[model samples]
Target: MTATRRAAILIGVFFLLTEIGAIAARLLYAPVLTIPGYVLGSGRDPLVYTGVLFEVLLVIAVVGTAVAAYPVLARHNRAVALAYVTARILEAAIITLGTLSLLTVLMLRQQPHAEPGALETVADALLALQDGTLLFGPGLALGIGSILLASLMYTSRLVPRGIAVLGLAGGAVITLSTVAVIFGLYGQFSAIGLVVALPVFVWEISLALWLIFKGFNTAALERMPRRSVDAAGAEVAS
Candidate 1:
């Protein structure tokens, strides 16, 4: 297989890995997230640790998808491809903040005879930080990046137009809905919020599977801009 094709496959794998890490970590973090004072009660530290590991890997995969896909995508539109990479990196950074907060909570819990009242307040603040990261990282950054990348794919026909349309639709819905939530029209964790997010979730999964099984459209590659002005005022083509 060509290197570009292999890169597409790797991107697909990273996409799936992100999903796995997100869901598994959420489930594993329930004890600390849901139970009151669990963080200081000799709680399920190991479980939360596993969740942290998953999230750390998730962050890696998030950046990997952008880095791996950039070269192939840049052939079509360098500006948009670069934007997508930037968005993914931003998303990863926000997620890293969330993960670090979780780690801090864990560290606080491990302290001998941790004070209950103070610990609870600090834990609540950390949880709020994680929630903010989720909202901005996945909800805003991912949504914007998806829209940009999907627009490129649609115009360039790198993948099926239908899949590209789905990506666009998903991004629009999630982004707009997130804004509504931010404005206090509804709670972010509400059922309505979940419903609106379905499209992006499906879009990601469908895109990942297509990349893994089908790779990029060859005709699209042939049609991509091959010549451009370099920084040194030299014309170059590949």
Candidate 2:
């Protein structure tokens, strides 16, 4: 297989890994999410640790997707590709900070005679940080990066135009929804927010599966300017 195709598949794999981590964390953290005191309770150590593990995996996956896709995207537009990579890196960093907060909560819980009120306050703050990261990292950064990358794909025909359109639209909707939530129009995880985010979720997963199973469209690749590809590669390397 071509190197570019392999990279595409790796991106899909990493994307899938990221989703898995998110799902697993949600399931494991369900009981603890709302109950600030739950972090100190008995028999929850494994759950907390496992959830943190998944979150670490998430960090890895987020960065991996961007790094893997950089070359292919750079082939079409070097500046946009670099921006995408930067966005993804920022996303990963924000999420990593969130993960560290969770770990801090865990450490606090381990201390003997820890103050319940202090634990609760710290936990609440950390959760708020996580929520903010979701809004800033995935909601804003991911949306913007997806739009740029999807546009490149559409213009270059790297993927089907339909998928590209879905991505562009989904990204815009999510970004807008994020703004509404920030303005207090609704909660972050509210029904309206989920509805708007559904498209981007679908677009990413569909794009992932397509890349894994079908790879890029060679016809489209041929149609792209050779000069553009070479220039982008040089830019990335530099």
Candidate 3:
């Protein structure tokens, strides 16, 4: 297969892995939370630790998928590829820190026989960590990254304009919802965030399928206008 075909296949695999990872994390959330509660018999420590593990894996998968997309993006649009890559890397960092904060909360909860004051202190620390990392960091990074990727794809014509627009909208919703979550806004908005995320998920899956099964339309690329040559010259050049 050609280089473009190879890149397309890889892109498809990346998205498929990402989708699976998202589902896995969602499924694990309940189990992870129940573990701490089951162990402590009275507290929610097990649940917290399980959440930490879930978040960590989620971050890893997201980061990995983003990284995998870089080569394909480079082949499609070199000018915007670096920006997309950078945004994804930064987003990954934010998730990593957020996961660490969650882990910290879990560790604090693991104190087998602590005083009330100690437990209170730990709770306070956990709250602070959650606010700083989970509440703000990952949300902001992912939001901005998603927007950048959307814009890049749109401008580069790497994918359908409508899909790119959907991506941008989805990113905005996620970012705004994160802010709302932090500010203690209506609880229903959280569900709205998930609703907004659906379009993005669909677009990614469609892109993956197109790449893996259909590959790129080489004839279309060949027919596309070339800035370096006039129509007549371009035809001859080809």
Candidate 4:
């Protein structure tokens, strides 16, 4: 298999892994997020640790998906490719911050004697931080990054134009929803939020499967110059 095809497969695998990890983490953290002040004194639960682990894995997968596609994307337009990777990494870092906040809440809950009011206050603060990061990272950064990458794909014909359009439209919708969230027009994960975000979810999963199973269009790829790994480890195209 070609290196590009191998990278496409890797990206697809990690994209799915990211979704799985995110869902698992959400399931495990449901109690803490739903129950106010639950994080303050809720006895040590192994599930919290597991949730944090899944979140870390999600962060890794987020970055991995972007990096895997970077070389192929850079071949078309290096500037936008770099921007996309940077946006993804920034999103991952924000997610890591949210994960750390959750872990910290868990650590606080494990303490022997915690002041009830103080602990609750801290937990609330952390939770708020986590929510803010979720909106900023996944909603904004991810949306923008998807748009840039999808635009590149559309212009270069790396994937089907139809899929690219879906991505672009989905990205725009999510971004608009995020703005509404920031303005307090709707809650995250609300019916409206879900409705707005669903297209992007579909776009991403479809793109992942397509990349994994079909790879890029051969005619499209042929129109672009071929890139090879040189002895010095740089991509050199002739």
How close is every model to the real structure, measured as TM-score? Answer: 0.95, 0.90, 0.69, 0.93
1 or 3, greater by TM-score = 1
Candidate 3, residues 104-174, lDDT tens digits: the string is 55555567786657665665555456446544544566666677777766665666677678778877777
lDDT computed for candidate 3 = 0.61
Residues 100-177 of candidate 4 have per-residue lDDT tens digits of 998888888877687889888998999999998889888999899889989988999989999999999998989889
lDDT of each: 0.89, 0.81, 0.61, 0.88
Candidate closest to the true structure, highest TM-score = 1
The root-mean-square deviation over C-alpha atoms between each candidate and the true structure, in angstroms, is: 1.8, 3.0, 6.6, 2.2
Model 1 local distance difference test score:
0.89
Residue by residue across 17-99, what tens digits does model 1's lDDT show? 99998898888877878988776776447888999999998999999989998888888788899999999999999999999
lDDT of 2 by residue, 1-238 (tens): 8987898799889988888987887677566577747656644478768988998898899899889988777767878888888988988888888778777767766766877777778777877787898788778877887787788878888889999999999889888988999999999998998899889888889889999999899887766544332544542232
CA lDDT of 129 in candidate 3?
60
lDDT of 1 at 89: 98
- State the TM-score for model 4: 0.93
Please identify which of the two predictions, 1 or 2, would achieve the higher lDDT against the true structure.
Answer: 1
Model 4 stretches with alpha carbons more than 4 Å out: 227-237
